[model samples]
Target: MGHLWVIPAGPPLGSALVEKSEVVIRNFFLPFLFIRIGLLTDIFSIKDWKAFVSLGMILVAAYLGKVWGSLLSLIWFKTSTRNDLLFGCFLNIKGIIELLVFLRWIIYKPIDVQTFSTLVLFNLVLTAIVTPLISIFYKPRKRLDRISKIDNCIRTLQSTLPNSELRILCCIHHEDNVNGIINLLRASNPTEMNPICAYAVHLIDLVGRALPVIVPYNTQKRRLVANSTDRIMRAMTRYSKGSGAAVKVQPFKMISPYNTMHQSICKLVEDNLIPLVLLPFHENGEFQSRTACVQNFNKNVLSYAPCTVGIFVDRGLTYYHPSNICYNVAVFFLGGPDDREAMALVSRISSHPGMSITIFRIDLLENSVESENDRCLDDAVTKEFMVGNVGNTRVECHEMVANDSKQLMDAIKKEKDFELVIVDFAEGHMMSLLVIQSVESIKQGAKLLPP
Candidate 1:
């Protein structure tokens, strides 16, 4: 009856209430109940040879029963052997409810004290070993690492085929992220010739649930919808419809623990052959407690992602647009594979009618030495971009030489106000530091100046 009511009544109880209830039950009730049960059970009662033989039989019978049942059920689904075995191990973990049933059977004289003790010991042993067993059999991180090596060869915009569909995985954290993501998608300028396939995943932290689930919006059966998720889905639908055949949106809700979420994401990317992933920047306000977890999640995604991972720092791209004005965008090219990827995306965004782009090719004067092969690759990409955008008034390219960090800062400041700025994630570069400082200064100047 409780399970039947959950479909219709679960959301009304509120996630907060459900989470608190789970915490109380897990941390307080279960431990206390287990202690009480331990006090009632006698380990010495099962010392006889007959009791020892019965205990051994029970352990074998229980484990084999669960494993055989799991294998039979999973064979029809064609799941992996490891998964089948893991599921069987999981089923062997008997919780408090099962212990209560055993106690009741003992009270009713249906099961002897030795049998009850053996069953309890069986449960304890299974529960203790299941986690380690699963860890040994199923290594998600290792699987992802293998996938990363295979995907690195082709999972990038620069390597994408010409006039082919662009697949992007967009991760949304909340309603605040919806508008920024939609705006970014629009700015990509999807068209009939170069269509986009967007997978918008709404990420929800796992709470009050034992297993994580990924639900597709169209296949969901629940009548009550989460407001934030509903809004995100509706916005994605609207964008898909408005873009006609240019954009195809597939929305999904992923409820998972942050610790293992990256594995799921990387798997999706590998399966779909997606070339890019867009993650929202972890904000430092309101949800401060979640910031660290989100930051860690982002780091893991970057580390394990099978494709290019972009952290979008949205600075009012959706709210600051004015009518009949071209959106100004600036791209800083520091000359690397990451920067080349940024340029590839910039080429796409520059196609938007309302966008005007300025490409700043910055070269350091002090440590200007680059490998001959690397310089040729950079020149090839830049030359291709310049040749393609030749005679296009909306696109402008500037070659600048910076002698030091201060000169880099001054060079960036000379550019006009831009609504969006794109930079590569090249570590250990002084240019990255200067760009960050310049962006902050720009934000301060914007606040100080009137609209």
Candidate 2:
């Protein structure tokens, strides 16, 4: 029993005895003692009216005093009301000390049997109520590392200048996320003037590991922490090499539980001062259904991410053919922050020689032309690419109304084929951009591409 208390400061020795055995201690040691106290307690002893009233009044005063003090401290410190109540409840908890003191009072006959029983019952009731209330109200505070200060003043991402760097944080887990992301990076067409810095984050769910690990592949540390993550790093490295000129890639492997992984990603984004975060869409496709944990992780990241987030819905552009090849891409703009960002990315892709792009701007039948307030810089740039020779003959622009998918597909069916479609993450109007192709149609679309 004495040896059980000896704990080191790290790893298997300290973690197993202290961290891992907490559940056992909570369930067995504490509950057994509490049950024993309950069995020893006499319920009928509280029937004495004078003793009951006196003990109840004392208990109420003590509880209110703790609550008042906690409320004052929380207010003075400007803490949240939920935490204020939780702190009060935590302070009100009567653990073994209270029980022991009361037991001593009983042994010394400071109170009669009825009074003692009432006081004990008061202690137990207050403790029970406080424990549950605190549990309900308590939430852990969000903490960020030291890296959140860089570019913290910037509000939104802007278009890169000729000499500017476009920094992106890309998150991936499954191999299914590989193709579309690589294609999207290719579309960016990093050049000598305006370079691209992509941080490829391979998020792995921590299992039986004692500590979270962050492994950087840019260093010469060749010890593979995880095999699957190693494969992802290698693939990203190859992609980076094949993408010539100003494309730089740094692979990072993070091992954390899914519940807290979003926080890690946010810290990474803040540290890197990344302007954009690309995440895989959380819907089930033909290959795999999204796991509940991963879906929840995605939701949390979307909610708490420090940078602009784009959820890519990969509709099998690379699934059919080699990702190294150039793709026929289309951009659908429905007018929102996300759509603007998508268009800005596509504008960069238009500069690539091997890429062919078509911009589809959706318009309402009631208003064929966009209002002044609705027009943005992204719209202006797309229009410039349409008429000007910046992209020369590679880019084309078209306008569409409510029912235009049928017409657009038919038009593409006539002369050319579109391998990938990039659209904003929006509902109703933008969803029309994600057109499903049958197996036969996919084969036909592939044939239309130049060999």
Candidate 3:
């Protein structure tokens, strides 16, 4: 078999879970022995020394059985000590599996007093505590290519969907521009999916009452929470038609009291397993600072969101719908994993079966570079992804004679009409300013007339 096929799918829950898995592996005897001790702790059980000795012997046998089996295989197979030890440790993590065996024995009425009682309490509490953590380290086999593209998938979605509607999650403060946003969602001809959902997870303090955050136990109390979320959704749906691409409002619980709005938005996306259009108000100034988004906050909800997070600007260069005209969309690539991912995403969106794209890239031209090779020019777009040019479509790797950010913007504005200049691999802060300037130009209706 190929080395790739042998590779496990990701270790989910990341380093924290992995570290815990290692702990579970290292301290392999404690939890199990404690469970055995718990069975002996029962007052109705054996009152003699022989009974305790027998129980201890069985525990010792099981321990040696696992450790010896691992050591023998490791020494015989002969790889690295570290690898062998890790494999041995990983193999002996039998919290859930052992309990399952014990349960089955009890069901058949064949289990003895000691084994039955030990396994019962073991499965119920201690094993339950640690097994899930151990399971995190082992993953089902999958392609490395697939793993590299999408980070941790919370759940693999069964129903494949073609997204059409611009899904928006509106956080209404005082509800001023709320109507405008709803109207925009209503106007768009979205397919199959709902357009917008105005959700309000309000922060409130209940006087002289404290609700415990206990799942399954708090099921009855959670029904009241459903009403608020349902009401907002109904209201948004009411304004537009109750069905089809309609704007809907929803509210969720402020599950974590201290979670920042950004992180909450991210977590909400992850928890629900959906792409969320975040409608945060974008002003004429700079966007929210990185620190402000998720700093000093104990938990980050926004950082770990699975799906695409779209932040819609309230005003300024609105290119949400750009009149369906061929505009120069110049993409910059700096050559890395991030750049590669960006290229892949763009190619998926623009490339098709027969048609070509008017893709542009930046290149530096230098004279007297080389004799035969003369490889001074840099073509950022990889050849495999770029198809041949057709009609008005041409892949122009613009030789950088002399053009900074503003100059590049001016050149594109002066030379050709563009829907929106999408830069793929830019330094984050610099990109923000370029985007703002481009938006301003769009707002002013300044035209280059004709190139």
Candidate 4:
């Protein structure tokens, strides 16, 4: 009667209720109830007054469905209002059901792939990003810190990055009262802790008066997020101290899974330039697992970036697992000013000892002239892309020209699923082209890659 979906997922809450509550999305298990009860039969199919009632019911359901799901999550999961809103938005944003609808409509198979994907991506992106944003951006009065100059501090600390030229650098807190923090840095920098390199730093804390209340930190019993954090820190410290740090397990206070860690790392970045953050991963099935910061950073801040980030999933500081995680990387090139900048980014992390890289010319096209002058420019284009090597990752220039950027994106999309998509998106020019594809992909519900 409220015309809303609760969770929008999982098994039956009973057919009688589901039949009336299925709304418009048919892929979910409840849609069968809508059909069996004939709620959508003559009303929707015949487009009669019955259909009018059904449509009204569906609209109501979507709204209530989202609300119920959010409220339930907040209560059952002990999620903060911010997390509950995010969870509700994620649930109700609606998509697995979208595919079944498209399948039903696939009789009209002459669909535009990019255009269709764009609509879907745009809808989902707005819902996913914006729905929770309302909750995240507006916060209670208690959490605001007076020190709002973290960005300036970030700049000052950035200049102090150790081995600014090295492929991999570890910034540690060799003498912090926060044992967990110290242990983590210690494990990650197992080589030799350069006492001068590690220092204090901070990021724009998630707790802004303007932002929503944080996910409750003290709810540590329900497989708390910080448990994994401790494991990661210990691993890094052990690696840094070379089995010598002998740090025993000690429980730390509750930590914010995503935002707090981001701020901590940002603070660290102010003093140390560790491009990669090695986070501990517990197999507890969380999307924001070890790479939460990576995803968060890519989504919220990388474009405004001063740097690129690598998120580490710890596998203990064993002799076999050393400091090596992902030494292999891939870079995309479009042969533009941004492509040149992307190459410069490669310089920061390429110095690692065993990193191997594959560079792709997703698309490069120059007018072929009958005269030699055209050929001269083509050669220059090739030379412009020649960004030597960084550390162990030998930059291999893989060249292939496409009819256009969509085709290039298509080609790259079909290739291997990469950990990251590095694009040379220097404003204007082809950057506009990528923006279109990005929008289309986003509309179709794909996450955005760092530009």
The prediction achieving the highest lDDT against the true structure is 1
Model 3's alpha-carbon lDDT is 0.39
- Worst 10-residue stretch by lDDT in candidate 1? 429-438
TM-scores of the candidates in the order shown: 0.81, 0.61, 0.35, 0.35
- What are the per-model numbers of colliding residue pairs? 0, 0, 5, 36
lDDT of 1 at 318: 42
The residue pairs in collision within model 2 are none
Each prediction's whole-model lDDT (CA):
0.75, 0.64, 0.39, 0.39
Q: Write the per-residue lDDT of candidate 2 for residues 1-21, one digit (tens) a residue.
A: 255555544333554456577
What residue runs in model 3 are displaced by over 4 Å at the alpha carbon? 1-150, 153-189, 193-235, 238-259, 276-302, 316-438, 441-451
RMSD of 2: 8.6
Put down candidate 4 lDDT per residue, 1-451, tens digits, no spaces.
Answer: 3786554221123333444554543466556643432321222233244644564566557756886777886666776776566565556556445644543343366543333343344444556766666566655322312122324222321233443322222222112223333433333232323231332221112221223222211222444344333444445444334545322222222223344344434333333443333222112134334344544543332222233333222222222243453444466665443444445445443544544556775544532322465345534644544533423335566877787655765776666543333453324221111111121232222333433
| Number of the top TM-score candidate | 1
Displacement of residue 346 (Cα, Å) in model 2 is 0.9
lDDT of 3 by residue, 1-451 (tens): 4564232222222323444566776589657755654544453553455765676577657645765677676567876554444455555456556765665675577855555665454345434544564466433212222321345532221111324333334443223334444433433333244243444343211111223121111212435334433444345546545544444445443322233344455545445555433333333234234223222221122224343322333442333322232323444443333344334434433432221233444432322232332122223335545542333244554434323555544545554544333332222211111111233444332211111
Quote the lDDT for 255 in model 1: 81
* Residue 93 displacement in candidate 2 (angstroms): 9.3
Stretches of model 1 off by over 4 angstroms after superposition: 1-16, 64-88, 95-97, 107-109, 150-152, 219-226, 318-325, 364-371, 400-415, 426-438, 441-451
